[model samples]
Target: MEQESFRERRQAQAMGIDLPLGNSPADIRRRMEAIEFLLERSIQIPGTKYAIGLDAVIGLLPVVGDLIAAAMGSFIIWEAKRLGLPRWKLWRMVGNIALDTTLGAVPLAGDAFDLLFRSNSRNLRIVKRHLDKHHPETQIIEG
Candidate 1:
């Protein structure tokens, strides 16, 4: 019976409809890590100790850059919500995205802020903490 249930859950997830309580911790952790990688440290700065990703590059556009970045950041929050995070944490994530978007709207400063702030990475950390506290069994240890 348990095996059948697990199979059903997996099928649901495969169809892109993640069950609220059916996702394994490992799956969640993996998804969050992927998001962090895409949003934060996908590329290394030459001759510098900094890394960035699409978030920074997209934020380089004049007017629409910040908006695109914020939209991408929203995906992290959406995943957190799907994980059943509390309202407070969800709002905090939104606030982080909002701040990132607002400050990132500046001409040159916003682009720099996108590199420094890394709102998607910040949101990923929040999701990790919530998972660690609430679903420790799903935590994946990285070497």
Candidate 2:
């Protein structure tokens, strides 16, 4: 059963379909956290305390790169909307994506900005805050 489920998820992803993380708030939170981690903090800078993920690395491809990153970032907002986040909060998340994409398009300077401004991480914070306050049971004790 588990293997079948995994295969289905892989197939869906291959075909550009997005499966729901799960039906529960906890499941959604976990999925969003994983996405955020992948997009913003999956890689370390070898010798420095700084870290970056696919967002920064892929943002080096000029226009196409920024668009791809923006699409990935938008997934977080979509999840937040699914969770019924307030309209204003959802708008704020959209603004983050816009700013990140706009400034991240600026050649050398935009690439530098991607390293410092992690929009996905910011959106994850908003999602987490909502989960922690409203669905306290979804909270994970990070050590």
Candidate 3:
């Protein structure tokens, strides 16, 4: 069963498809966590405790960078919607993305803000809270 699922997932990837059929709560949690990592904490600065991800790195490219970051951030909201999150929660997530994109568009200050704000991580937290309450089975016990 696992092999078949893996094969189907691979086939979907090969065809540039992202099927929603396989999006169980656990799957959504994993996807959201991976995205949060990529956008907010994928890299650690050498010899320092600070970390940054593609969101911060790409957000250095002026207008285009902020736009790309906003788009990536939108994916988290998309996944949350899949879980039937409340409208208010979705709006809150959208607001975070808007704030990040708007403020992060302000040249140097924006880049600095992107590094600190971590909107994706915020969205992930919101999703995690909802999932924990409504989908406890998806909770992963990290040791």
Candidate 4:
């Protein structure tokens, strides 16, 4: 089972406690996949056929939408730290959030931006690729 909560996994890593399948690539893939669900929207979503996701609906909450979504992006950043992603790549992940938040803050445009940008999900994929290259649990520090 893939837990989409980046905050929870980041905590587990910081504690040096790897839950079962928590550090596996499959788990990373699954977590990253959640971003997809969050970015989904209604009205057949332009390019996509279906229309549904936490992001579009959540944005309707007003005031809390972007903040909550941005916080979710932070989890990906935190996970990158624990998983030992390279600084360059890590920044790229951070940039995703920066861009996402900026556009998501707009009025009507922000909603459109959130639907298209999907920063949290995109950042997760970036980190996910790094995890696949080097299994998080098997990482060994080499000074």
Model 4 TM-score, 2 decimals: 0.62
TM-score versus the correct structure, for each prediction: 0.80, 0.87, 0.86, 0.62
**Best of the two (1, 3) by TM-score:** 3
Q: Candidate 3, which ten residues in sequence have the lowest lDDT sum? A: 13-22
Error of 2 at 31 (Å): 0.5
Residues 38-101, model 2: lDDT tens digits:
7898788999998899899999999789999999989899989999999999999999999999
Best by TM-score: 2
* lDDT of each candidate versus the true structure: 0.81, 0.89, 0.90, 0.65
lDDT of the structure predicted as candidate 3: 0.90
lDDT of 2 at 141: 87
After aligning candidate 1 to the native by TM-score, how far in Å is the CA of 53 from where it should be? 1.0
lDDT of 1 by residue, 11-101 (tens): 8567544443335766766766666677788788999988888889888897698898788779888878888999999999999999999
Candidate 2, which segments miss by more than 4 Å at Cα? 1-4, 8-20
Which residue pairs show collisions in model 3? none
- Model 4 agreement with the true structure over 1-143: per-residue lDDT tens digits: 34655667677567543433476555545545544444443235579676756666566555578777777657667767776778998888878878877677788888877677766667766776676577766334559
Best by lDDT: 3
- Where does candidate 3 stray beyond 4 Å? 1-21
Worst 10 residues of 4 by lDDT: 34-43
